[model samples]
Target: MLKDENFIAQNDDLDQFNRKRPQFGGRFLNDESEIFQYNAWDDVEWNDEQKFLAQEKIQKNCSKLMPEEDSELLENRAEFFWDEFYATHKDGFFKDRNWLFTEFPELKRFSCSSSEEKCQNFQILEVGCGVGNTIFPILEAN
Candidate 1:
């Protein structure tokens, strides 16, 4: 269970309801040309050297379980890249999240507490929790 801090307000102004009358009622659907733009491969910038280095790194780290020539390796590399990227920025990127409960008081209800009836027996299990992301948060809350 996640518990929010008590210092925050339950409701935020951005979440408040606005009762003002609408100025326009008719829906206007815009053409796809005006609403969206799609680019072909020609518009993309590809650095073969960078791509080669990234691919080599992935194959080296994962023991080349997937073939170096495999397209699937690209996707797998993307996943690994994001995982490592977030891991590198973990502390700096997540620092603000420490105040989430204070920013939104309503979330405080989600905070966890030891079960009074069986506090000693309480056990928590988390899946795919990397480098104490979930563990540290629970410890901080407690």
Candidate 2:
């Protein structure tokens, strides 16, 4: 969302593509948000009892669907839960995940420079019922 404010006319390079729809292309960059990317790398100061209690809580929440008792039912239950969630929210949950480029370089490499190569260059494996917020922005940036 940055703009030239110094009254400078910059010739933005336009990338052209040929297709029924156009692809979104932009340079990945960061500004202002990352105040400090460095970490001190210190270990957590949790006691043995506290650590055990935290693990128990995580395990309880993770296995709330009775995964150990019935694996098939757990899978179906998770899918149904996500389906209901998306059915309730719809596109309200979908958003532009421009940060994906920073973590996953392959997404940019897979993105086609030309619209003619759209959907023909790579494979996108959609898991669960996500609203395509992560993939669509990288593929359809205008």
Candidate 3:
């Protein structure tokens, strides 16, 4: 069996709900015609028709079931597939996620900024597979 590390943040001093929301991405797709202009949009609102279509697609896709043998085979060799993907694409597949810090500002609290302040025993353990797109940026943060 494989072991995985987890990070749980507990702060009795701070009220969870009263925390200020972080303002990050501003890219919005106002016009559906220009949807292809960018790879992704930040805040997007879908119309009733679009919402219905999305639901229909979800229902249609969910109805189809894969064979147990096929699923088992994929799960058995999941590591190999992921390894091949990273070997072929390397870290180039994803851009460094700078948005992580903006989205989760709490991560910055873990790192010690001044010499006078003693840093807590905090550890960020990223389990499963990836090209380090997420963890690398956090580690690089001051």
- The collision pairs in model 2 are 24-140, 24-141, 24-142
Query: Which regions in candidate 3 have their CA more than 4 angstroms from the true location?
Result: 1-22, 25-27, 31-39, 109-114, 117-129
lDDT of 3 by residue, 1-142 (tens): 1111122122222224214333346667788898787777677788999999999999999999999999999999999998998899887886655455556667655755445668687767776455555776555443
TM-score for all models, in order of appearance: 0.25, 0.37, 0.56
68-96: candidate 2 lDDT, tens digit per residue: 65877667698888788889988677665
lDDT of 2 at 136: 64
lDDT at residue 142 of model 2 (Cα atoms):
24
Best by TM-score: 3
* Worst ten in a row by lDDT for model 2: 5-14
Compared with the true structure, all predictions reach lDDT values of 0.45, 0.49, 0.62
TM-score of 2: 0.37
- Candidates 2 and 3 compared by TM-score, better number: 3
